[model samples]
Target: MSRTIMLIPIGSGVGVTSVSLGMVRAMERHGVVVNFFKPIAQPKSGDTGPERSTTIIRNATNILPPEPFTMQYAENLISSNQTSDLLEEVVARFKTGTSEADVVVVEGLVPTIKHPFANELNYQIAKAIGAEMVFVTHPSNDSSQQLKERIEIAVSAFGGHKNTRIIGCIINKVGAPLDDQDRTRPDLTEMFEMPSSKTNTNLEVLQMFGKSPLRILGCIPWNPSLVAPRARDLAEHLDAIIINKGDMDTRRLQSVTFCARSIPNMVEHFKPGSMLVTSGDRSDVIVSACLASMNGVKIGCLLLTGNYRPEPQVMRLCERAMETTGLPIMMISTNTWQTSVRLQSFNMEIPTDDAERIELVQDYVAGHVDKHWIETLTQGSTLPRKLSPPAFRYHLTELARAVNRRIVLPEGDEPRTVKAASLCVQRGIATPILLGNPDKIQLVAEQQGVKLTEGVVIIDPVTVREKYVAPMVELRKGKGLTEVVAREQLQDNVVLGTMMLAQDEVDGLVSGAVHTTANTIRPPLQLIKTAPGANLVSSIFFMLLPDQVLVYGDCAINPDPNAEQLADIAIQSADSAAAFGIEPKVAMISYSTGSSGSGSDVEKVREATKIAQERRPDLIIDGPLQYDAAIMENVAKSKAPDSPVAGKATVFIFPDLNTGNTTYKAVQRSAELISIGPMLQGMRKPVNDLSRGALVDDIVYTIALTAIQASQQQ
Candidate 1:
């Protein structure tokens, strides 16, 4: 079960999105897999895209959050007195997106004239999802006592703080302490619309909440950079025409300057990232800007007024400077004063493509948030650590990054393989060596919009096949001593890659995106062989059920094992589960529960359980249990009351491949869950096989698993 944290705004424009994003990053820094969710979309005025919070999260991180329901949908439900249905929908979407996360951060809807029931909806949704609340508010002209009363009222509406659902509060956009001059003039405010002078200071706010049950998470100070818009945004807002569109998308305007003075005086305001607004006839100002650009000053852009374009001669004279500096230049019909007025009321919504600013805001807000509180939330957690699918995948990526091994991909020319290889290299999961024709692989990457960076190594099989032929001949000389057969076998990329792994040239191998499973696993069995265990190779798939991740063993290998081989498979599966961070609660599956029924299969399972228990008593191993009794608590209590591993089994060992494979496919397809592998265990070297219908993400995670396996062998 995922823990939920809801951020509710005390008033409009409280920066709830930023607060939610900050909390997520802070939790991630502590190594928790966090998911961001917004139940309803609240599009601001003139905004036609997706909700800002979801967009920012998707662009900034690897997590792909679910799209929010539109406001119209919620409105219709509320109008028809179907609010219960609305909350049911919210809960369904929430569970769908967050079932695989350790923690989920939900951003509540902001109260506006268009939606008066937002606050009530927020409360109802939080209750429906069982989310703890974190009230987000800014100190805007409210005294200490006034702020305390406001929060008290909100808490009472939320069933009071006695329930402890209201965990804490964040004071965002805290203004700087007022100086004597500012204190004397109560109406004075900063240029960037900082908190008013009447608002209480940080100390006053904290002291006010000292006696309250809610914790004061942090007081985030006002940051003007977070509210600044890019030059491209300004251009779109003013409907300006481009004169020299350079760095418009990336250059952010930190401040606006009106060049009303002469060249000597106006040049003093030429700061980097400052937008200069002046009449188009000011050739002197244009010449000064060109000179500043030549001297390494990167002003955001030059905004011309009154539909003016610079004289052709002046632009021609500064052509070299413009070309060298790539200064962003644009013109608008509005005069200087009009433009300034529009700038004062500009929209400050963060765009989806402004990745640099999004990262800046995430880091900035996370830095100001309470680190000790975050540590307590993550380190001192008392919730059950049920491994979800997202959490498992996140764990794989982090583990693979720590190891940083090289993995060989045999089907590099395949489109999905090429994209997955590029992603792995870019994300530092592994250094994947793609074995194919370099030109063909490059063409595939270009077609897929994947940038093959320097980290993605492309090795042509034709050049490397000859080198491996002699080594393969020596390794398999006992089978038949012939160079011709070795060369012929080396033509297959899977065989070549397996030989590489056998020779210790690469850390691991992942293939079968385009090849058959036999083609992938045969070479490894022929060359690398099994580990120094007294048994055959077996396979397991990490079945990602809705609530937790379960392990199903012998699903892809080993048909009809006897008592001894079944016991060995159980032991190997348990070891693999433990290695990958899953608690090893072994359940030997059969058609019976305990001694209820007798058959050859049930007897085999019973004997296998006893042998496994004798071999490793530390593991929780029980046998001859039905699938429902092994997994469901009620069934376990009724059918196998005294069995230790009757319920809550994380690893299931089948008596034969026929049962295992059919059961795994049934559950996987019926539930539409993600199944990670058929990861081969008991291999001397780390060699894994993939499915022919694998997606890019499936391939990437398999590579990560292979890397972790290689590291474990070391």
Candidate 2:
């Protein structure tokens, strides 16, 4: 849809900068090409040259237009008494630059009591520009209805056109110290207003509404970087310890560039609020400096200006610095001059002053104002709005909403496994058919403190022996096993349960909780084999953390796979990511990016990368890459500038099982990140293997993932 959406701030009280930035950022997140426009900007007197807001938008977007394309002084376009000239200039900018843009986000003037011109100007701009009106208000208990009334009156006074859609209202900065706030004030919705709000604590409101009808385009948190006086001033305000004893504090720390010669000094001086300046290839130095400075002060971050790394002696010095300081260094991969230039134009203090006010305005606009009733009045049509389910709904409420799908959990000596399965069923996430003695399963659940409610379907292996015998006999026919022996093996029920998945009696199977990986996968492999076109079976650990989801491959299977097998692991991990709704950008992780390192291990990854590309011609695959190069954009750009899968890689394919397992665990332990799965893939159906020491949440997510996988197949 080619549409321009402009956000106009009426006056100075509301947080116009923050709201404008947030809308732009949110649009970017939605993969929409949007442009920011400010028709009339009045910066404080001391501010030099152009408006600070213009610079902020330009910095955030990294797009500097030439001459008329950029915003000029309001007087240049509009005459002294004619406010309409300002609106005309804004519309012209939108028409000129927004040819290919999906939306044009124009920040409006703040709403003021005395300056009726601001509101009048906004209404005229909306009408003249053929734009929809979206009012950004602060969060107040009764503000939703009041704002709606005020907007209706303003639009009416300005001669509202039939083409103009009062899209809705956005509430900013909710959740203050008021504990007894009435969020569900019925008057707001009854007043026929479209509402959406952004909270101060979580910036995910945009993410949430993006998935629903409310259409919360973006929720920008108050970024500390937006403040002014550079990093040094912020350090003083926050009482940050300065590591660089030699660098002058008054040197306008706006753009703290990391210098190679001063890296050791930079590492020591790495404070949270400052920017890092260093050489590009000196990632080792940069990483070490960050590690060292991680102890006391927050390193404002790194800015790698030069395209070079530190020498070995400097690297050694950085390592020592890391041992001394213990802080994380931030590194920017841009060239030194470019980094400095970008930093210089940006005024940091623009964000600090009115971030809270912007948030409050957004919350107020987004407050629970009804859109359905408003649509009837505005468009003469009745539309129903979908309200999100309340948080902490009862288990029955969720269960009633779920599709009926049957899953089987094979019984074993480890009753904890069965208990975990039973708990998943109770939680309404899965319907598990436990393959073991019902009495024994109950006993295990009791011992483990897991409630085995009526939801679980238990099938005793003794009673179901005959049902699995024929399948076991068929599976073991070529292995020189007699019917009796096959029957006994099938009595294990893990084998029988796997047979059910193979036979399509159940949608999916979950085992390996009590059994070893070998035993658990052996039966499935023998009977099910690889899926069509899948050459080899592999496993992946869905290493999920609070902030990110990473895939580590060959962690549970293939003790020490060769190059070809490692390649297979990469392809399988990529497939797993695709199955789980993530675009798989596979990186064959090693100790090197390209030819930076020597040794058979590096060669193995290089060969695996080639093999993986040959196998999955459509996938973006790169190899012999260090961990940082695979995930960090600056490192990726610096190390492998031409490589497609370097910095933006999502799936990490390890060279061997040892590195795969060890690296993920080390990251988990050292970083205090959560790791789920060692999830098995490449089977015919969705049968997953769990860790012998799996937690309840682990079992729950695994079951959910398995169900999702099975649903896709269906």
Candidate 3:
């Protein structure tokens, strides 16, 4: 079942729409796929009227609609006592809105709007929709008694409603608490819910209300930024034409300044976040506004009224001054007085156009809202936490940034490599050391329309040859290498980049966008060598499928292995999966599950499973299992009922290269999967190989995985 919240206002001007939208954004930020619904909206007169809160919300959030209702329709139903029909309509619309999302936030009616008893009407709506109420009250200095009376009225109104529940209340726009009223909670709860037996006039209300059900969740302080109107918004509201639209979306107009006075005196009113309004023919004040903008004075905007255009020569001068600054200029057809009225009436809502205020609310809601309350709302949620392909790819960048290791790319002159390096640097995931001539790398970057920022470390392998010659000679002495031979070996960019990693100059090296996997891994095998206890250097492809990230091991290495080596590959693949945030549930896949079929292949997998299980006792591993039984829960139940890892395998260890290679390709070709690596494991230092046909994003993710591996080894 989805979590449904009904935001009911105690009175007007309580910022209900903002609070509701903020809740949606907050839930969305925490990975909840949330939807929105406004059951009742106040009547609107014409097409040119301001957008309803629901219309604004749907547009701003990029969530499409089932549009909200106008109160006139709901008013007719309620006036004729057709509450059942009204409630059913709301319920039907809400179901449509929630069909695909995790939580649906239903914005209900505000008090003192149409349907004078809308709070009571809201209770019926809530009961029909099965919503929990979160009552919102605007509190102030004298709000102690006012809040007390309102709470009693609401509790009494909704008390006998069987289907609805009061989840909580929020003390909104609180300047502070009253100094004289008893501020203790137990005493306040008593006043809010009185005894029924006595009479509930004081006791008349108590007759219905057993006890106040309000749990005060939070108190959000009054913030002017949250309610400030954008200069662009006001311009659009008045049908005012914009002369210069620069930075209008971000420039907030907190207060208005009518500059009908002289320049010297009007300049005194030119405070930050104040919009100056004057007749368009007033060139003196217009020039003053432009000069203020040029001098870094943040006057929100300049509004020219009375439909009078500036002289051609004066307009040219004003445009010239504005060109040096990004201040907004607008022209209004109305006189100063009427324009001022429009400004006062302009909606200070979280409109689709104002990204600045939306961002502010995202931050505010994150900080002030009760986190426990938010979590409680989602505690019974059915939203899947599956690592989807896009989500998985996005998360890889985050994990890579955690370590920020240096990763060298050997194919720097290749366009894909250069573009990928720029992306890695731009995302702060890794410091990519691109090995190529600086000139050629820049030429390739320019061709790709990507700039290789200073963050990309460009080094000519030829220039770095002298530094690596001695070190390479020492590392390869066991193979009868001389300084002359080492120089020739280091001439290859992949070799040079690998030598950098082996010498501790860089944390990892990723190559092979243009080279073969053998060519990429050869230098590392010869120089960096395998880890101490590891028997072989194996490679695993991080197959990013539609719903999850899976590991296909030994697909790029070890053509065929006996039981012991197969066990090691399985163990290593499991470790790799866990290192990258996937808990290893190893499936030693074969043509048969258990002893259902017998052959050399089946026996080899069964033995390998036993050996792998012995190696990592804590791991959930099972083997001699077919792919269907391993990955599908229903198949596993029928084929290998008791195996822990059977249905949930994230790491698949292939029995040999022929099976592994072909299966991964089939999966990729058929499903259009994004395979990130042939990420080599068990190296003393980190060195991963990429596919020759890898996209820019593919290379970026490989570099990230290499960096993460380097971090783990460190």
Best candidate, TM-score-wise? 1
Name every residue pair that clashes in candidate 1: none
- Ranking according to TM-score, highest score first: 1, 3, 2
Q: What are the lDDT figures for the candidates, one per model?
A: 0.83, 0.58, 0.76
The residue-level lDDT of candidate 1 at 436 comes to: 95
lDDT of 2 by residue, 205-298 (tens): 3333433222333333332223324344334433333333222232223234345554555444444344555565766656654563543333
Per-candidate TM-score against the hidden true structure? 0.59, 0.47, 0.57
What TM-score, to 2 decimals, does candidate 2 have?
0.47
Ranking by lDDT: 1, 3, 2
Model 3 per-residue lDDT tens digits across residues 1-714: 677788888776667877877777666545566778888776433344444666666545545656777677887887898978988888898887678776777777777744577777788888787888888766533325556667667666777334248777766665422223322111111123323322112212222123334566656665655767777777778788888887787777766777867888777666567778889999898888888766556678888998987788887887866776667888988997687556545555567556557756654654456766776676777777555444455457768988899988888888888888998887889999988889888866754446778999998887777998998888888889998888887779889888888889999999888899889988999989999899888989988774578999989889998999999999999999888767789999999999899999889999999998888899888998899999999999999999988888899999999999999999999977679889888999989888888877788889888888888888
C-alpha lDDT (0 to 100) for residue 487 of candidate 1: 90
lDDT of 1 at 446: 57
Q: Residue 683 in candidate 2 has what lDDT? A: 75
Per-residue error at 278 for model 2, in Å? Answer: 66
Residue 121 lDDT in model 2?
64
